[model samples]
Structure formats: C-alpha cells, structure tokens
Target: MKATNEIKPRLDVVSRAITSIVEGVCKENDFDIQYSGIESTDGLPVRQLPAIWDALKTAKARMNHQMNQLISRITHRWNLASSIHRLPAEVLAIIFQEFEPIPGHPDGDSSLLNLLLVLRAWYDAITGSPQLWRSFGAHTPYNIARLVVDHSKALPISVDWRPPREPPKRDLGKVLDLAIENSARVKSLTASVPHEGDPHL
Candidate 1:
C-alpha cells in the first residue's frame, strides 16, 4: 500500500468521497441525516451506538492532531522564509530592545517577558544581549533584578523605584540595598520616598 503522504487527492474528489460516505451510511441505515439532527426518530442499535460514538471520537481526535501538525509545518516553513529570521543577531537584538518597556511604565517587564516566549531564536537573541537588560523598575523583584544585573555584563543600569501606596511584605530597604551594591554601575536613577501624608510618593 502507498503511504498516506504519497496520496494527493483533488479537493473536489475528497469532498465528493466524504459526501458519498455520509449518503451511503444514511441510505443503508434508513436514516435521513440533517444539519441539526436526524429526520427520522428511529433509534440505532444500543450495542452499535457505543462503538460508533467511540469511533467518531477517535476520528475527531485524529483529524485534530493531523490538522495541528499541518499548521505547525506551515508556520515553521513560513518562519524559515521570513526576512526577520535572516537578520543578524545584532540587528535582532536591537529590534528586541525596541520592545523593552519604557521606564516608570506600568507592567514594565511584561513586554520583554512575552518576547522571550515568542520563539527560540528571539529568546536567544534577547537573552544574549546584555544591554537590553540594563533597565530595572521599582516593582521589579529581587530575583529579576539579579537576573538583569547578571545579564547586564558590567554595563551601567537604570533604576526606577516608586514607593507603593501599601507597605510591602518584603523589606524595601533590602531591595534598595541590592540596587545600591550595584550603584557604581547605575547610570539613571529615579526614586520616590514615601512621606507622612503620601504613602504613594
């Protein structure tokens, strides 16, 4: 038998074959199939119903899997032929840097974090670029700050620390201390200390 991949049927032929199969099944069972439901209220054999249901479920799963595979292959091929992928690592890194969130912007880390999830190539390009990780926001956690510092590769980093309205569980002093330890590398700093009336200052 020929492999399934080797068989290429025309779209019309495939459609007709499917239609014929449905028509034949309906004709043999003395059933009239409709879009919503069967026309006749006649019931199928109880024993055969389970088998048919299971077969339909299995076929549906198989079709879904095959469709997913086809889509993935097409996406992979499209990416391969894309000009973005052809860019040099330096150029790609610059592009990724452009996606970095602006200082003091809410949800600062989200954009870069999402970029990391796009593709392996994009992840590699962003991760391998140290300059892109130089900016740190006030809400940035210790671990994330550490990661950015480590990746900054001795380059100067920008720090933005805005006092929150509510006091945080973690010691803000310690967080500042961590950033202070790397203060020599600090290029741009923006910090707001809470005041007596304004906790959000």
Candidate 2:
C-alpha cells in the first residue's frame, strides 16, 4: 500500500504527459497530410516517407505504456478466477472469523486484517460476518465505529480503550460515551485514565 500510494501519482503524471505529446503529434500529422496534397506515400519526396514512418513507429513504441495495463488486466482476471472463489460463502465467512481476533482485545493480531485484504474476492463474506465486527476500540472513528457496532447484530461486545494515548489525556467523558450508549449490550469494558497529575483518584 505504501508503494502503491507513492507510485500511482507518478504514473498518472507520466501518462498525462505522454497523452499530451501524442495528441500534439497527431494534430501535426493530420495537418501535414492535408497540406502535402499527396494522394499516397508514393508521391512524397524521396526519403521523407521513410522518416515519417520511423517517427510513427517511435511514437507507437513510446505508447508501449499500455503493455503494463494489459498485464495488469490479465493478472486481475487471474485473481478473479482463482480456486478460492469456489468456496461457499458460509465456509469463507467461517474461515475469516477463525482468523480474526476478538474485536477490541488488547493484543489483537493486526496483521490478520492484511491477510483479509489480500482476499479481495471475499469482501462480502467478511463484511457480512457478524462475528468479525464484535469489538470496539478507541482508535476507530465515531462514524465507522457506529457502523461496526451496527454490523455486530446486537451481540454482546467488548469495549476497549486501554491504549495509554486513548481519550486524549484520558478524558472519561469522551471515552465512555459509546459504552454508555450501548450499555445494555456491552459485556466487557476496559479503559485507561492518565492519573499522573490528578489530585482525585
């Protein structure tokens, strides 16, 4: 993802520059053909036709950038046709839940999320699985957190905000809102309060 984020903009810049040059060359070629009044290459000055042909060939080669796109499309199709897609949706959902750690656990395996990302074809199965969305963490934004809670299908959930930096100096009001709102369904709760300077415990 880091490489992708960096390389994509550079590729876009190069593609745009090449497209501009190609358009300019095309305009020049069209006007020259009209101005020459030659019905065919046979009537053109000696050697000029060969030079034009060479330039056209060079332009075509410069446009070989499309070859990368062709390869990408081929790989994309290959991934889409992978045998893993043949698994039933229920099986996929179960497998994802097996690999995914309890939501909002202190030592959850973050890398498992990366594994799920690689299996792009199984997005529906993963998101549709209620077991995978049963955790709430302070790091999740409010909007997405709401959706995650909603996706849990009213199952009792663990609420965790135990990271030291959470709640920004451990403001209890800010950190406990969601847990309070969903108190009925919150089965386990953990939080951290920075008590370094507080006179009151």
Candidate 3:
C-alpha cells in the first residue's frame, strides 16, 4: 500500500524488527551464540533453527529484491531527466556523426555500431540520419556496406577502397564490385592498388 519512496525508510524498521526478534529468541533460549559459531551451537533447539534460518533467508531475499527495484527506478528516473536524453533527435544525430571514427581504422564500423547500443534514443537518431551511413572504409565488410548503402537512402556516399599493404592473395573484388554497384550515389572515392613493381599486384 506504501509508495516506492516510502519503502526506503521502512527498510530500517524491518531490519530492526528482525534483529529484535532474533535477539529475543536467543535470550529466551539462554543461548550465548557468537556470530561465527551460529551453525555449531547446540544450546539452541533444532526446531527453532529452521524457523530462524528461514526467517533470515526470507528477509535477505526480500531486502535484496527491494534494493534492486529501487536501483532500477532511480536509474530510469535519472535517464529520463538527463541532458543527453533531453536533446533533440537532430542534435543527437550530429553528436553521433562527431563520434564517427577516422577512415582506415580497423575498428571503425564496430566503434560506430557501439553508439547504436547506448540507448533507444541514440539508436533511433543514428538510424534515422542517412548522412551517418554515407561513408565506408576499406575495413568495412561487404554485408555492412550493403546495409549502409541501403540506409543512405539515395544520398551521395564516399568510399575508401584501399588494398592492404601486404598481399595475402585475398580477393577484394567483391567489395569493390559492391562499391561500383552503388557508384551512381558515389560522391567521393579513394582507391589504392599495389604498385606496378610489386609482385603481389
């Protein structure tokens, strides 16, 4: 029947009540139990042990559940009132753009993808902005490239399709082929090939 805010104050009262009941039972049984030796105590009757253990366990579980609920409520309220959450979606989109990694970085796509996991608002803002998906790096995978092209929604795109320095005989033609397929929407392109003298070429 009480509100969530009132539950915190009641925790202390519940704790004290449990302590008083425990101490009363110990006193009535004339048991001089030490904290570490509770399990070894033979002075307390076996019938009372189960009741005492069950009461402690139930109290611990209930208090733990309440604590978790309170923490979740606090976090939810804090996020709702946070400045970043208050920003307009356009502003958030610009912020996401600023978080974009420099081209050629091996973790560029993964780093940008992390921004999408931050919050629902951020995910919506980034996904709704076509400009964010208009750039592709050499390290970008073909499937991800396709996703970006689709999300770009007819907007001009930039591609950086540079071959790695050392040749492992790996074929990059598929990546380039996809890039070429999207060439109509290409605004800027950077390509690198092995030097003519290089045997890997």
Candidate 4:
C-alpha cells in the first residue's frame, strides 16, 4: 500500500508535468484544437478539413518535442534543480519587485500582496521591503493616495491641469482647488490658462 501510494503520487506528478509542457508549447505556438467526426461515402459527413486536422497533428508533434527536451534538461540538471516556489521569501520578494505594476492591471497590487501573503516567511519578507511598494504612483488612480498614506513616505508630487482656452466666469482657481483636493501632497502645480494674447503668472 505504501509503495503504491508513493507510485501514485509520482504518476500524478508526471501527468501534471506532461500536461503543462504540452499546453505551454501549444500556447507558445498559437495552436488551435478542433474536433472531427468520420463519415460514410454515402453523402454522410466527412472528417474535419485539412486546416483543423493538420494543426492538431503539428501541435502534437511540437508538444512531444518540447516535453522531451524539458525532460532531458531536468535530468541533466537534477542535482542543482530547485523549485522557484521554495526560494527564500526575501529573494522571491526582491525578484517580484522587478515587475512594475500598471495602474489598470487586472490583478492590481493585490496580486503581489496575495503572493506575499502565501506564507508567514513571504509576508515578513515582502512587508519588510519598501522597494516592492515604490511602483505605487500617480497613474494608479485614487488608490495611490491610500498607498502613500499607508507607506508614510513623501513622494515628489507634481500636478498638471490644463485650463480652458477661454476664461469663464471663474478662473483657474477652481481647477487648482480640485488638484489640491485630489493631490494634497502636490509640491509643484503647472497649469495652462486662456492666452488671449495676455500672459499672467
């Protein structure tokens, strides 16, 4: 029973590895999968066209080649192979800090936070590091204000508000007020007001 249990786990691992390799190759090569049905000569449906069938054959061959190469490399480097997931939390945090976070990223900074929250070691390592949070900036929307407050780090703040081409009943004061309200830490403000051949500072 013990031997069988161990063998089962190994088989499961191998199966997952094979599946991953196959899928990875397919994705890299932009392979598409299709299903087909055999048909009779008597005006019955025939197998899928050359496009779908040929793509499947090519994809399978490519997948097998990739998996074989991966296996060879793993066997050659087995002694030095170490799972990335098992790396020291601090090292992983430093590695992750290399990726910049886009303001509208679907996962947001929450994605990195979730990764750090995976274990106590990661939490301590990530939370103790400040570089990971440096990417929180103006382009991140209103969430940046919260992040700055949480960090208690003063950032060089700049606000640029372009006023209308024609001055209305009210002047740039309203626009400046809005900028202040939104970005209280703003150290420098630049704005464009109506020219009308007149310049005011």
Candidate 5:
C-alpha cells in the first residue's frame, strides 16, 4: 500500500536519528561501543532494536544467505579494532592522564596505578611517563622524591601541607626545615598552614 510505503521510510529515519543521539551521549560519557559485549553505545540491548532485527528477519525471509555472512565479517573486524591492547601506548597514557590526582580526586593516583596492572604494556607506558610522576609532590615520602631531588637544583619548590579533618600531621617545623634546605636553589617557596576550622587551605 502507498500509505505503508511512506510510513516505513519515516520509521527508518526515526530509528536512525535515535541511534545517532545515543552514540553522541555515550561518547560524551567516556564510554565506548565495545564497553559491554551485547549493548551498543546507547545502552540499547542489541536484541531489542526492532529495526535491525526486522532487517535480518526480512533478509532471512528473502533467502539472502549472504547478509548473514556479511554480518559475521563485520563483527569480526569490530572485535579486533576495539581491543584495548590495540591502542597505542601514547594514546593510552593520555587517557590515563585525564584522571589526574588532586585534592578533589584523592583516589586518582591509586586508580591509575591499578590500571597499570591490567597488562605489561600499560604498566610500562604509565610508569615511564614523566608527566604522570609530576603531580605526586616530592615532599610526600613516595617515589616522586627522586624527581624532586633531581629537579630541586633548578626548579622553584612550593609545598602545601593540607591535613585531613584532624590537626596537622606533618609538623610546621619540618616544613620550615625543607624551605630552608632549598632556600638557595628555589626561586619561589610557598607553604600553607591549614587553619583549625577552614576547609579550603
């Protein structure tokens, strides 16, 4: 019927528009099409897509065996390209860097380190990146101390002691000692004493 023909094309357009909007939302949310196996980027259960299933049903009814074969080939290619290991080291590192560790995101440092354990390639690239190491201050008795030791000779040193809810765990005297220790080499020195009641130090 002519009426059915016009409605079918309009329905197809609506389905495609919905698909495009869902894809955009996923990308903005930092999720990929391959994030979960069955679902598409829009969180749609692939099985429930009436348009896609209808097309397959139509092909089957028409005895279009080649359509199934084509679908299999496309699925294979998609799986290979979407593998996390297929990503370049530089690209992965950049993605990891997006979750920067700061007061706002205290657990970011540990999370990035955990991500490094996923595979040898991620571990090597993350550990080897200097930009990743720069955020962890040398004052913290962590491995970043080496970077501070090496760069302290020329770089300006700024230390901010932000204690948790309790009183200052690190003594003010110790911070003053560090300032004096690098007084000759540091171009600028900044030290923050957390007020007894202030949340923003």
Candidate 6:
C-alpha cells in the first residue's frame, strides 16, 4: 500500500536490513536478537530463559512480516517495470476491442475476461470500456452477459441470438430480458429458428 516514492526507499532499507541480518544468522532456523546473535539452538545459553524465547519469537514475527513486505515491494516494482504497464489504459481498451476469441475456446468470453484480470491495467481497460461490451450473444454466461449489458452503459449494443447448441442455451431467457430491458440502446439484433434437421443445427 506504500506509495511508489516511499516504497523504493523502504524497499532499499528492507533489502539492506535483510542482507545485514542474513550475514549474522547462523542458520535458517535459529532466530535470536542477542548481541552476538544466535548460531544454533543446541546448548544455546539463552535458550532456557523465557525472555530470550520471547525475544526470538518477536524476531521470528518481525522476519516474517519483513519477508511479506519484501514480496510486496518486488511485486510493485515488477508491475511498474512491466512492458504492459507502459501502455496507456485507452490503448489497452482498443486492443481488447480488436482481440478475437481463440478458435474452439469452449468458455468464450469467460476465459478472455479471466485472462485479462491478471494485470490491474488490463482489468481496468476491459471493465471501463463500454464500447468493448457492446457486442455479445444470448448464449453467454448469465453473469458475463450481465456484465456486458451493465458495462455497455448507454452505448448501443448488438445482440446475437444464434444458438451454439441444439437445445439453445439455458440462460437464453435471462439474456433476452437483459436485451429487452436495454431495448432503447439495442441498435442491432440477430436471431432465427434453429432450422429443424439442419446439419449445423
């Protein structure tokens, strides 16, 4: 949660602190804050005392927290340095609109949506671009269909009701309702009977 300005310096400090302590720690398991530091658990002079144990526990907790912070700092740096991060959100939105679904990808837009969320930038681009949500089909998953409808906002949308399967789709009714609810913005519609006994049907 630290700002970039704060994170860079703090990360350097954490890295230095970790490097310093790692030089002193005798082993990975032994965590002690004694002046001379703890080399090992076997026959450690302070191991028998409660205060020493408390100090070690605190040290362990501190190390764990620091490790977590280190990971966060690294991730923050990675995101900032990533090539995708260099692309503007508007450009990402345009890219999303131009992208086509993979051939025979069973999950359709669902997989694309899930994949786009890996980066904060891509997620924002997809969710914030109403034009990207302006074209979808009745067979889309209910939740995804809703997202498309809601995110499309006042933009005109094109609906495809051509079924992908024999039974059509279970969510067809819900998708129809969504289209009708936003009928004022429905600029284009495509639907037809399955054509009984048709080979593609």
Top model number, TM-score: 1
- For each candidate, C-alpha RMSD in Å? 7.1, 10.7, 6.9, 14.4, 16.9, 7.5
Per-model lDDT = 0.70, 0.63, 0.71, 0.49, 0.51, 0.67
Going through the candidates in the order shown, the clash numbers are 0, 0, 0, 0, 0, 0
How does each model score on TM-score?
A: 0.68, 0.55, 0.62, 0.31, 0.37, 0.61
Which is the better candidate, 1 or 3, if ranked by TM-score? 1
lDDT of 5 by residue, 1-201 (tens): 577336444766766655554444445544444333224435645554565455445545554576677877886676556667688888887987765343212332546657766666677667666555433332343343344434334544444334444333354445445545656654443345656768544
Q: Residue 169 of candidate 2: its Cα lDDT?
A: 37
The C-alpha stretches of model 3 lying farther than 4 A from their native spots are 1-66, 105-110, 165-174, 196-201
Name the lDDT value of residue 165 in candidate 2: 39
92-173, model 3: which lDDT tens digit per residue? 8787787664455354545667888877778888888887887775667667777788888989988876655545223366
Off by over 4 Å in 5: 1-82, 103-109, 137-159, 166-191, 196-201
Model 2 regions lying over 4 Å from their true place: 1-69, 101-106, 139-144, 163-175, 191-201
Which runs in model 6 stand beyond 4 Å of their true positions?
Answer: 1-39, 44-62, 100-111, 166-171, 195-201
Candidate 4, residues 3-46, lDDT tens digits: the string is 73364446667666655544444445455322121231123223
Instruction: Assess candidate 4 and give its TM-score to the true structure.
Output: 0.31
lDDT per residue for candidate 1 within 27-82, as digits (tens), equals 55555443223433235555555554555566667768988999899888888778
TM-score between candidate 2 and the true structure: 0.55
The predicted structure with the larger lDDT, 1 or 3, is 3
In Å, residue 103's CA in model 4 sits off its true spot by 5.0
Model 3 global lDDT (CA atoms, 0 to 1): 0.71
TM-score of candidate 1 to 2 decimals? 0.68
Best by lDDT: 3
